[model samples]
Target chain A: MDSITHAPSTEVLRAIVEAAADGVVLCDADGAVVLVNGAAREMVPGDVTSLLDRGREPGETYETTLGDRRLRVRREIFGIVHQAWYLRDVTQESARADALRAERERTQFLVEAGRRLSASLNTRRCARATAELATGLLADAAMVVLPPGGLRRTAWLRSSEAGLEEGEIPVAHADQVPGLAEALAGFPPVPSRWLDPHQAPEWLLPAGFGPVGHLLVTPLPGNGVPAGALVLARREGGAGFDDETETLVRVFAARAGAAISAAVLYQEQSATNTILAGDLRPPPLPVVDGLELAGSLRAAQQTALIGGDFYDVLPTPDGPLVTLGDVCGKGPRAAVLAGQVRHSLRALLLLERDPEQLMHLINKALLSSYTPRSHVTLVLAAIRPGDGVIDLAVAGHPAPLLLRADGVVEEVDARGTLLGAIRSGAITLRTASVDLAPGDLLLLYSDGITEAFGGPTGREMYGSVRLMTALATCAGMPATAVVERLEQLNSDWLAGGVFDDRALLAIRRSR
Target chain B: MDTAPFLIEIENPEPGTTRLTLSGDFDYTTSADLATMTPTLMSRGLSVLEVDLTGVTFIDSSGLATLIHLYDAAEEHPAEMRFVGMTPYIVHLFEVTALDQVFNLPTSAA
Candidate 1:
């Protein structure tokens, strides 16, 4: 190898510069272009000097746009009196980076959409969230048209520069917006390109919004039916909805649809339950000529507000028939059975005045019913207001406690088989009679009162002994005050813990 | 209220006799277990069915209904169903519901 070498000639240097893949420009100290490579001439097409910043320091780089292409330029000192500028086309590289950023934004938007949409079970709130989330990123303005619930009108929510607005549109108005009716009917959405933005009705957009440039309508599919539809719009000259945005709208519509439909179903079920529970609630105690009566009932399932414990006072020509019963089980199932038992007692009271005979009739009625395991524990009391005598019959229930005027609590001596429990169809009941003097009260309570699992330890039961003790304190109080005080004490014993259904009814002889 | 886990153990103390030992809460939520075990309890050659409830801590109206249902099934099978073991709490419940008269409970357990 020869060690001695000299610099290449001008022609060779020029040839090497011309062969480079990057554009090369050489400028003299006075800023006049001295040489231009073939690549540099192709990159600018015109004067390349205009693309370079004269004030830029050597070794500094900058990017600039030349027509449709992006170019990155680097300035460097080439020799004692010359500066070199290198330029490379970066259009495709920047485009790829922009695409990646947009994809990430779309993913992040969907994640936010899922979290916001799933936080509510209310229909209006969910629709509002869907519309608010779609603005800024997905469109300039967004609207959500809820599924038609009533026959005449449907609800709508809109979000735009004016903020959120809600209104109800006539059901027939759905046909005015292109593709809206089809989308609401659970049909596949038409592509945004297929829709004419000019055809959007005035009602479909917010007030003062300019001419629409792009429109997209997508159906919100539900469990088995259509939940609702989404409407997106962009102002005139704004970016049109592309294929990626359309796909994102479909995914967002799916989540919104499930949330909306679930909310709708829940509202309907709760409304129905409310009606049924209203019927099962305890009735007002009738006013007896010589007696004062008070009753209170609480359900174990607080949401349902109906449970197995129930009490009713029915009036007859002779006196009022007071009935308290607890059907087997809890919640809605038990509530239905308790209602049946109450209705049966009312019907049977018209035929038989004796408490024992009513018990027998209810037993036979329940045993022959189609529902299995329909056991009921009931107490029927027939009062003779003239003589202040109460005829009591207890069947598979806790006996009523007699509170004398002097604070002596005695359990009424009555025992019987549970109504509808035995398959033999034969029930034995030992009925008893008790006289109520003035100021004396008779208290009938469900086992929930005595069997309450609450105390200082949080696990102990509020047993009968405790109940009798509590009753002793309320001997001289009014019937209403007595029930209220007892309930308060029991609730305090629970100490925020769970409890079962409790029913209490008090009868006081006033004269 | 927290409930104890319910458990049922089946054993054959002698020929033609099936003993079911039940422990824990015997309320509405757990009564279905006994009702489902009824068909299996009434096998061929079943002369007697014995229920041991000494380990039972709680019994609700639904639990009583399940027991009554079991008794009805046993009667239909022409077999004698007896309460072999019982806590005083159960005995008191049985007496209150008048089931003590209907069911074949042990005299000593009463």
Candidate 2:
């Protein structure tokens, strides 16, 4: 102790304390402020002793809010009789953490919105998801006004604590809510502050809902068309829609709009397809005396139901003119061409009943068609009821099979150029006369029957020989039974594999 | 069923003559490739266009349409389009559609 030379005095300690960045205060054992640093005086200003907790144990730390500023205070034993209090301003740090929390919440909400909105291709369901997602986070209540589907009314879905509700409002009623009419018309949203909440119509809110404090209206833009609009409401006691919340709403609306519009487009396309397919479906065969008729058609594209192959039995005074044809290509385009051919055949048949003459007329019609490559393979059979004679003319089509009562099948010897093919417009026909004996069946089919790509190896064709053999097995059966049996056998040969459009028609002479 | 991949090989064996050798399944899905190549195949000075279908395993209605389209374009070009090679299956298809009467097929195919 005697060897120590320079010991710092209280003045040096006071100077060092005054120069420190943190606010420091010293208190005597009597619990009164004995010394205060420059930083402590600036922080506390008027009452430095009031900021300290004299009862706190030494080295204990605590946080306190002074006015708008946040102070972190720690108490420590200075010497034996004095206590030191350290204070730090942490106001900006806490505010930054709060902003980070808000940012995370916004990101989470968007992720959840995307998940819910993309789950449905139905317009109403998508609208419902949009309204539900906007509630709680964006507003106390949210409403989605769907685009006007009819002239008189538009649908609306609302979500709140009371649960989801749906209703229709008159198209003109959109104007009752401020900015709603413009938003529904696909205009940009009117800022919430610009619109008065008192102008909101009663129908926009649920029953027993409190007075609206704020209202936000935004348009849902779609692919070149307006999808709908979104309406948000906060009750009188709730927080008003701020800038950040409004921006979030705009982003959410954009996604919801795209999903709803896509669903609308899909619905329209499928409806049109259904109507076209319905028109191209095979017609029921007309009953011809002394003859049984049956037919079946299966398209390669199962969803379309209509294909390139078609058959119709047209009634005539002389007899029934049965036609089976395969148009080039497949699906809606081919089905449309097939429909055109059928209509042309009907128009041509009104003037000409002779199978060969009809073939020439159809060939002329097809060759003159604006659609290129509109070729068709067809077989026309004119049945003579009294004598069981059928005049058959084959045009670029497979020969009709003769299923004799004795279980013998023969391919009719007939050939002709495909109609509408050969830009030269020349088609030669070698028509044949077939005498259908009692219980004899005549079968006309498209090439799809023979070209099916399934068997034991899953790549072998069903082939004409297999078809002939199969036909021979159903020699004496009724026409319907014969057609059904042949189809069942072919489907089995395919074994659930992919296939082209197959068509089969049968004409039988009953005993 | 898995279909064979379609391929088209073009060659100029002689002046003013183009030979297209087609292989694999030439059906609805793949016939567009040939149809799209029609303009290029029917270029000016194409005096003779020879098609070889010996390597082709299958042909459908769409494929048949494309061939007819090519033939029509050739006829319009005042050029001769002929089938230089074919399988028995294609020969039967030609005979059925009576395209054999219009298209100039090799003697073996006939």
Candidate 3:
């Protein structure tokens, strides 16, 4: 088969080779390329002509990728004098398929990231995911900085040198990391807005972030208050983030922001709850000779802060002291003030006597630290246990009702000014001595009980008269039962709910 | 954002005296308002301040603290504050901590 014997003119042969879509190469018997068509010069790599000598079996095809193009080659014996090779480019077709695959993977990554971010309410875990997400997608390193009331200056970071680092830096260094400062200040919402790492503060250049080319700082949106920040960096000479990448990072930041804020909010609430629970837990009432005491307190509603209502009965050297009082207002602030009052009163107990005179000293002590509108109302009684003699003093407080041995209930004739109401004064707290007979009991309560209101419409106050009527029914009951009755009656008055802070302390003289 | 937790109404019922009527929840939040108002009121050369708290439903430690601090302001101005219209129970709020003697208060029938 010597086709060269009848070969057509070179011009016509060249026209046929140039018009073909596939590349055409003609080589000599020694495997040297003698002629190449226009299509062959454009589509096929120049080195493919060497395959003619390798003596590939006829009609054999080889496929490989070169640069951005995919190419296929075929060898054929032409008239036995020379071998011809054909090469075709498939770059565009393969590129379309590869792009489709990458798009699918990116979608999957976004879906999985959302799930991981919201998986747990634990703040640290969520924050860690946020840091990893940056490294997972766009940036080589990341940091998440939480606002104060949390880690303060501590931040979550991942870099090339250190796998993942939770670094605690000085707050003053925030000047170096401009984006971090802005994030902490709740300024940035757009991603990669501060991408020019070159323009970063001079101090930030050597920030151990390792030759950062670009930076993206964003705020973790606090549900109510911004919780912290997310900062990401890429190496120098790396491709700058394009619009699509910025959008992707923005979406991720939003999810992480919401998740982190939720966790931080939950942590704060849990802490507040722990403190509230501890503060509201009442201490055990102490037992004294020939005296029985019972006490209880109920908050206005669920999740209310610990209030400033308190009661205590202690056995002192002179006599047994019984005190119940309501500090002005409620909540943690009041609780702290009441705590100071209680401890100071405890210390003053041994040194001072005569309720009115003792109140004078207590007033002076309270004046030591002047807080506006601060005043204390209390019924303090020093009882000679078993002897049946009780000395009671009132400091601008509600009168204590005495359940006499008979069927009659009498109000203790007591009067006084409020504590610390005057800077310099001998307090006029009224002190009265009354002999307690067997079966006589004394009850002290915070106003939360009587002030409680309920009716069919829930607006009628229980009032002092109703409380007195309720007490008349508990005449012969034990001290514990009396306290229970007080609470039960108050609850019954409110019917479906509660009023302000309520406390009840009942002490009965043993027969 | 919301309405003030409490309201304070000021008036000059008589010469040499200033009166304030308070209503609503006067707790931690409104304490500063009262604190700021008192010093300015005292600095007006008034001899007495009369606060009517009949309408107040709640008060907190900050409220109390503000009052104690006002005592100094009153002294500096050589004026006096008389707190009135306290319910019997509210009177007890001022007594337990022995703050009753620090301010001039209404007499309890008891």
Candidate 4:
């Protein structure tokens, strides 16, 4: 195909070749530089044609010098007879491909760090993930420092190193480097590297920190606020961290801080919940002989150990009046209302001299002051000293069990609506007049004691029958002994699991 | 629990009344049971279906999705559906999803 082209066509081909950005060249099969385009000539100048004729294979790359510059040359077969050769310059393309590859690797590292950061919510897990994420993204060992209760001086290190326990680092030791310590004391995600371990103060070196390495410490903020530092280390000879690595570590640290903060909040809330639950449990009251006395006084929900059940031996004109009641519900609301009912009942009982009138006046005040939504059930009994008469009244509560000296268990069924259940409603407080013969005993309690489900069948509740049976056993026991026995039985029935707030009151007629 | 193919029944007696009577737990494990039952009910073309949930004691999101899917499917037929006989806890799930307003919920005291 040896067709001779026109002079204009040859000139057009030369112009097109010169206009191309790539370096173009022509050589003979024997590796002689036959012709070179303007780009190729500019890339490799000084008539280096003698070097190209050294019989190199086609498509083989070779290095050449053009003036003061270095260029890479590749030869390839072109014509049908393979007599002509093509030379191309590929230095710039090679550099661009390398940059693209690096960028892809950095992107992949960031994506993996993000995936690890989202895997766990535990504080320890979060700290470990943060360290691993940092190390994976950069050529460094990562460490996390958290101050106890957000205190800057109290250091807690959660680092990537094995066998490193938190709270081992003293801030005084960490602050040996005033510069590093000061930067951490302020807001974190602090971007700085401390390369010299000797420059790092003796105090700043964590307990047992060994070896020499390049250090990169960044400020980290927990969900509450920026409160810690993420320190990365690259052992000598390891690649120094770049901006891409720093950015990736910082991003992962921020997410890790948020997760740790959430776990801390969950722990705090759990503690608060425990306290709230504790308030519902009735306190261990005085127990002696075979009888026991149970009562509670509530202040408010947040206040520890405040409740409504109360018992005290107060001097009346005759003897002592035993009182017990349950404000519906638990926590602060019950506590507040319990205080009102307790004081009103106490003050009225002392002044009015009549238990019925006292309860009526208390109900009137409760109806006027309290909304219909709130209510409480109460039981009041007046015992005469040296006298056998026991007067009792009930307001929507369990009937007190009477343990007679003759071993007969009598259930004093008294009826009344729960206080506050009705607004301005009158309670016909009937006095159950019972003759407390020698060795007679009475037990009063809140519904929680009876309704509590315990024993072999955890689901089956300990109803009034069980309480009466337990009371019968305390026939001749002292008032204190009676309550102690009941508590033991209740505890046994619970099988070591107490669920509800229980309040029990026991009164005995002194022989 | 075979964990295989199952049937779901959607019955409507009159216009403006739709009933999706379910017979199984509606959770992740039984999601496909409702998936198979959805298209057959859509063919009848009713405007309102009252879901008889009395037979269903427990239901999860898979079951929840059946209702949601039915609700969505009813929209295409231009029908308003209601849920009935739901346990108090399951009704709470509906309230949480904000589906109580979208679907007619039985309002009897617990």
Candidate 5:
């Protein structure tokens, strides 16, 4: 007999079946377990071959219990009077389906919470909504910890499905809020999941929520800083908190903090405006050249002082240097321009001998720096001692009033367009001879004085005729008295304050 | 005219013709709010309308516009409009625009 060299086909087949990840079993006719692989043998406990003689009929379905698992046996008729059976173990697939379902449920819950948060407008309403949603959707109890004297506390607490309940939780000072303190102190947003209730610092847990079974604490970061902490607690029976809840709470808290800060700033500006309007008087002005001069000193949109209308009298070696001018507009910005003009004149006067030269320098200085919105109308005059003659220069300003000793009034006809009004334009100074004999006057006044009205008919202006007549009548009075009378006349002429602030300059040749 | 010129004079009052002279400098700031006398002056029944510029040494564009408005209104009566006491500069402004022909301009004291 040839030594039977039997190939190990059966062993190879057994190895293939045992290597399969799924449990495999082979049964014969009558639905009895005829063969079982390693996986199947290990999965089933009790007797190893007892299933082979079971009284199961051919082509019958049977439920068999093996160890802790349940198996399904199905028999089928093979060729003529032969039967085969297939067995399957379906535990892991069922577990995978359950996990997917739970994951979907958690995502839906987070989406619903986000929608509710967006519906809230103001910070207070948003906070309440956020607290309720967090507690209700996430755990047994939740609290949005606010900054309390630079700490965190459950001042407002909410329970699952219920609104705020009456209770106060001890605050966790900023130094004691566990991971939160670190976040607020300068760490980026942190999400912490605590498996053991007591693992986190005792101060971090709210007073009422004892021994957090599962706590998800996340930092509320705003404008690159941690504003506060959101604490969600889960009791033993509630769903465990996850990353989704942490992210949602974090986003809502950041937006709420920013909105609250902006509202506070708006309130402050409103209060500022009220105070500013109440105390809007003109700024104080300095006396120029023995003239009690006041122009529009109130500030406007651009500069702090109204610049156009200017008046100043500085004492020089020659005599008192008198400059009365306007930079064009009224109000504070014009006043600032007026101040600039005055400053330029002061600087130029030291170097230039002629009034025209001084004005030319001013023009050149303004041309380099003037904005399109600004222009100046100026009249510069220099008076010398022992001479009644005044070197006069005009740049688009009103003529000065020259009062003669015999009560004859002459309007200085010095003609020049306003300085800085025409670029590169020459400043003309016409030498006008006037005898400032005793009792004679030189009055330089702004337009505000002439437009004033005294009577019920406010239409008629306080014309120059009245000014000349008043000047003629008041010529004999002292210089101080003359100015007072003129101011009084101006006040009486207008119903109220000078139609505009009157900048009046009076110079009488003293005997 | 049966009644005094539709005019209310506080400083100086004339007869049938009421004159309201605006003197010194005129500009947008003062011109913004019209005085109540503007309407009252127009309401008066007078044949001669006189705005004495004699006392007015300076006038800005705003003042010139006001005078033009008054002149147009007074044109309804031929002999009613007269601008007197114009400074040389003011006259020059009116003469350049030929507005002197539209209203009676008082000659210089010369």
Candidate 6:
């Protein structure tokens, strides 16, 4: 080998090593200190031989720190007596790497959080999911607060040692629900300091709740105003919810807020619609000389008071005309259709006395009207006051259940083509006459009662069998009590909730 | 219960037929979205408008109403509007409401 290339002079090597920015060291095979460069001298202040022991090896690279400096150290045995070390001060690089890793983790977390938040449209489930996703990751605990009447509600959830548990947290006053008033005030991410856990509001600590040290109350603004708020609590040792983390939490809350807002609007509209749909309601139950009439109608979702289900009682020249119908859908549109059908039936009652003929006229009107055609199932009963006789006409509606004073439960055999299923002039219907004795009760209801999908198995339909069985239990009951019993049974059948509006009209004969 | 979100996809199958695909539950809140899209397609001057209900999972009174209104609009525009890719449930729904005689709907049960 050429002398200069193969083995430069010690002085030239020293000059080269000193000129390099990275720390360089040379040692003997025994790992004893032989020589050190300027950078090495600065990085390795003392005990250069011991540093050689850590660095001297062939094809080996590792990381270590020397005083305040982080170093990427590499070693190679240049010859039998010479071992060379290369040390790079990697402090800034390691910091950048750590920051990049942290950023990726945060991005991944936020994406997952956003996906989870928007996955469900159900307000309760979405609210609960918002709390779970924020807990043990974003904070120690999280709570979803529905600002009720801008004040109070019946149920709440709390994070405990056994995981998040649900219960009713009764708040006596509006101010007791911490962070609600403030959140609604538009001051979002309201950082609250809790110097003592005992001092926290009682509602915040039901029976056994958080040992929280701090809280960040963030308002979930739905359509500009705050519909609800998410309360994130950090147990002791947290430095409160910082602005950066608070921003992410607030964003999550905002997405949750939008869903809450939709539900809130739907509920509010349904309430107003119940009052507005009053025009579509059946005329007040006329005081029959020898009978009692009663009915109840409510939205299935519990969020709305009135929907597609409606009941009407009209006093005609001949007798008392009773109608209960369920339009094909719910909400304002269905309510409108229900109103139209009821009002039209009342108007048609004057022109035609036969229940079957009236149904034909109504069906024709529905098909020919410029308004969108909606399928409706109705049971029209023309009960002769003081005569104990009812003429029932069915149109794709559930059969009426009759409870006899003799304790026999029977279903009316009346059946007809569903209105709107056939052309207006082509509808086929039949009227059945039933003779009722004193203390007998007849129940007219929507399919929502018989089709309520639940039970012990949760998959079994509340078929006509169960409905008849349930009605048997209400034998000899008053008209109002009979309807209430059926409503209670329907509610009980649905373990969790209902998916259809229910309407029931009951008539009882009294001697 | 949460109402499913509505999806509206407008695809031109051929030169003159505009196919609008609807999916998710069509109820009071969401049927309006589909209704709002009909006039735009009607005014676009298509020869034949086909509503693809293959993706639609459920429809209610308002949804049917929206369809009826669309049919009415199609008639005034002189566009031959039709329905295709209907599920059996939808076919049954039309049959039950007697709307089968009014609007051209798919008959085969799916």
**Best-performing candidate as measured by TM-score:** 1
Candidate 2 per-residue lDDT over residues A1-511, each given as its tens digit: 5787787998999899999999998888887888888887887778877778777888898988899888889999988988889988888998898889999999999999999989988989999999999999899899999999666899999999999999999999999999988998899997899999999989999988999999999999888888999999999978888899889999999999999999888788778767766656779888787889999988776654346888999887788899999998866778789889899888888889999999998998888889888989999999887999999999999899999999999999999999998877788889999999999999999998999989999988899999999999997799999999999999999999988889999999996
Q: What interface Cα RMSD is found for model 3?
A: 6.1
lDDT of candidate model 2 versus the reference: 0.90
- What lDDT tens digits, residue by residue, belong to model 4 across residues B6-68? 345755577656576765445444656666666766666566667677655444333554565
Candidate 5 lDDT tens digits, B1-74: 01112222333256667766665455544544334345556666666776766555445434554565566556
Expressed as tens digits, the lDDT of each residue in B43-105 for candidate 1 is 768999999999998898888889999999999998999999998888888988999999999
Candidate 3 C-alpha error for residue B102, in Å = 10
* Clashes per candidate (backbone, < 3 Å): 0, 0, 36, 36, 32, 7
TM-score of chain B, candidates 1 onward in order: 0.96, 0.97, 0.86, 0.73, 0.72, 0.90
DockQ of model 6, rounded to 2 decimals = 0.14
| Model 6, residue pairs in steric clash | A148-A151, A282-A312, A420-B97, A420-B98, A421-B96, A421-B97, A421-B98
Tens-digit lDDT string for candidate 1 (A273-381):
7766776688867778889999999877565545688899999988899999899986667878888998888888889989998899999999999998899999999
Docking class of 6: incorrect
Can you give the DockQ of every candidate in the order shown? 0.70, 0.72, 0.15, 0.02, 0.02, 0.14
Segments in model 4 whose C-alpha atoms lie over 4 Å from true places: A1-319, A335-354, A357-372, A454-458, A488-498, B1-110
CAPRI-style class, candidate 4: incorrect
Cα-based TM-score, every candidate: 0.87, 0.83, 0.61, 0.47, 0.40, 0.47
Which runs in model 5 stand beyond 4 Å of their true positions?
A: A1-307, A427-429, A453-455, B1-110
| Number of the top-ranking candidate, with DockQ as the measure | 2
Q: Give the TM-score of candidate 5.
A: 0.40
Reference-based lDDT, each prediction:
0.90, 0.90, 0.72, 0.60, 0.56, 0.73
Interface RMSD of each: 1.1, 0.8, 6.1, 16.6, 9.8, 4.8
Model 3's chain A TM-score stands at: 0.61
- Please provide, for model 2 over B1-110, each residue's C-alpha lDDT reduced to its tens digit, 9 standing for 90 to 100: 88999999999999999999999999988999999999988875899999999989899888999999999999999799999999999999888888899999999769
Residue-level lDDT of model 3, residues A1-511, one tens digit each, is 7655766887898788778898888878887888787877876546655434364687899876766678778888877798788878868877888778867766777888799988988888888888877775667777777666544366554433356666556666665775677777777554464456765553333256557787777777777677777777777888777776776777777788899989887787768756754644567888787877889887657454556677777668887788877776556656666777778778888787567667777778766766644567777888886688888887756677777656467777776766655566457766788777888888777767876667566766676778888888888888899889889988988887546678888778877
